[model samples]
Target: MIDETDESLNKSSLVFGNFAVLVVFVLLVGGVYLWVSKKNKTGQQVFPAGVNYLSPKGDEAKKPVLLYDFAKLAESSDWVTYKGKIYPFSFQYPKVLTPLTFPNDRSDAVTFKVNELSPEQSLLFTVETISSRDKNLVGKPEEFAKNYWKFFSGLKALNKITKITNEKGMTGYQATYVVKGKNAITSDNYFFVVEGDDEILLHIGDIFPTEGKAVLNRLVNSLEYKK
Candidate 1:
């Protein structure tokens, strides 16, 4: 028969063990939270199972190649300037594309879509405020873009996300992809820059046919943002 003192000691030991386990669990959870928070602040993308990411290229020649006569396009195509009503940003686009409506508040999304919707003819351009600071977005814009690709609903990337910058000094992100049941490939480019407490998203989407893509790339190269 065990003594009453032994029973009390055993009970105390069991309780102490349970308490220690709880403390360890809490510490582990907190460490994970801090790690994720740091990753988000630095901009990291989470990849899904079975999804592949291509290694970045060392030279411009090794990246996904898109050939077009930029000099000819720049020399011949008429261009127009577009200023946002909500965000203090502006950019230029060729006259071949039409500008659509956007909001006039703290954030907006301006789109330029081709009038025709052919598989190869379909093209789109968009500029908007990210509103992440306002909406309390958990991660950086790159992370958001990666999440977009991971669960893109209908599209998957054809190449790795690339880093790009415009002549106006605005840095941007670019990703190219091909959707199922579509004859044309698409490129989604996202430009983000911070102002005050908000970040801007200049998303450019283009479908195949090298001419239109070239025109859009020209427009991207001309993007600008106000201080």
Candidate 2:
């Protein structure tokens, strides 16, 4: 009789350890697969299937190489005008995109999305009201944009500020910045700063990258202020 009870205990312990190890191995494989699915080489990061976790990121974060053409937009007929209800301005967006007004009001801004898919998400469109009294924006939208970005949290770096003009021939400033995180990337998401009257400034950020920077260029250039 070679210690039968002790042998049984050792056998049970070995079985449990092996089971635990198997479970851990499975979990590790699943986690790696998920991460690889999320991040891509071209910088396109895909969000998991769900509305709660969906937000703009990845390839759209890269600073766009500026190659703006306004004529194509002029020739295109697939756009619809989104007039501001609270502000004295209007812009055009592609008909393929659906616009959702936040708070059920256009008083703030509008979010446009082709779908719930990530890496290529909504275009964050908003015409913000900034104080016109700020001396930074007195005559220079560029300065206003530069000064505005200073307070942007997690600002990792700033791209060269470029002078941009809209289709209406109104002047604005385009600026790009990188935020420090996997979710917020650097490059290509363009922010346009337009000087309002002596009491207001309009800030628009084109966040839709799936459709290409040309679409963003069209949207920015289509902006026209009635006031």
Candidate 3:
């Protein structure tokens, strides 16, 4: 025979068990909502789209070493290459100098101006190919500079015409000369190069001031004859 008291206690136990389960379900739903709301408020993407934020990793990943820093890399060297169209030679210039530009006449000469100079500025570097058309034309360095007022007129030789070997082992002639401009400001240095069929003249002026001697030397030293 079943007791009435026992049956009543069994019914109360069943109701309490169901109520406990309902309370747990409500708490779980509320926790998930709170988590999503917090993430949205913070504007944080815990993981990429379609990725499970709850995924686990065995260990933390190592930070990658950055290989590129444009500003710093630019400091290493601002070299720009220029290939000769008439001759088989190549040279480089720094950011302070402009790239070589051929005039509309496309004569034997190519000119590179100072980056900071105006059109009226007198400071510039030039390379001229001794046109093969003139078999009598000598490939000597001074042949290109004799008529150039800055290289010949009032020229005080700073150093003897010396043999210079570029990085590529192409031997050339180099001589530094002192010349004064119309403004009466004396340029302490002028550099010249004479190779196979080409001659280069670098006229020192306000663009390459007295304080930039080392930089100017480095730029000149980078010249190379591709041939």
Candidate 4:
């Protein structure tokens, strides 16, 4: 009877050990499956599946280039003289000029007038060549800046200056200002005051409309100085 009892006890212990081993194997496999599933869901690793890496061929990636010709325009204008360097003023829309008159103080200075289509545009382009003596009398750039502020107190009041950049490409001191008031709008006015040179070129204008930007870009792109 004692021998039978011992054999039964040994069989029961072996069965429990085998059952525990099977449970541990199952738990390990389940843990690995969960880890892999979580990794895939979180996109931590790329799947071994194939991917299409090439960009589509139909789309042209190049930007359209703009071109302009100022010489051709200068030839057509009677008001413009070929003896001096020519500045181009070409636009998509027809521009009508208003009568221009010289200021009482600056009799030699010439001013050309035009009507701005909207409040957001400039209505005139003033170009003047100052003599060396006049430039010296007025003082250099620093003095001119001080005098400019004194004369145009509105400029100081509004303080719409966005940037004052040294535009070496255009060869001058470029001070950009945002216009104010009901008709006042944001526009670009380029002032080119060449150092030691008395001649100052002022290009005051508004940006072309979205539809006209392409043509305007071409016009500006064509700009060149006759040296």
TM-score leader: 2
Q: Write the per-residue lDDT of candidate 2 for residues 36-89, one digit (tens) a residue.
A: 877754354332111112134655443333232334544568899887767777
Rank order (by TM-score, best first)? 2, 1, 3, 4
Clashes of 1: 0
Which runs of model 2 end up more than 4 angstroms from their true locations?
Answer: 1-76, 104-107, 115-123, 132-140, 181-185, 188-196
The lowest-lDDT stretch of 10 consecutive residues in candidate 3 is: 47-56
- lDDT by residue (171-203, candidate 4, tens digit) is 333232322222222233333444444454433
Q: State the C-alpha lDDT per candidate.
A: 0.54, 0.55, 0.43, 0.34
Counting clashing residue pairs in each candidate, in order, gives 0, 6, 0, 0
In model 1, state the lDDT of residue 170.
76
Tell me which of candidates 1 and 4 scores higher on lDDT. Answer: 1
Best by lDDT: 2
**lDDT value for model 2:** 0.55
Q: Name the regions of candidate 1 deviating beyond 4 angstroms.
A: 1-73, 102-107, 113-115, 118-123, 127-139, 156-158, 178-185, 195-199
Residue lDDT tens for model 1, 28-121: 9999999999987663443221112122234411233333444565666577888867656677876655666644534444554432333222
* lDDT by residue for model 3 (85-110), tens: 65444556555455544455232233
Error of 4 at 119 (Å): 14
Judged by whole-model lDDT over C-alpha atoms, candidate 4 comes out at 0.34
> How far in Å is the alpha carbon of 10 misplaced in model 4?
99
TM-score pick, better of 3 and 4:
3
Task: Give the TM-scores of the predictions, in the order they appear.
Answer: 0.52, 0.54, 0.42, 0.32
TM-score of 3: 0.42
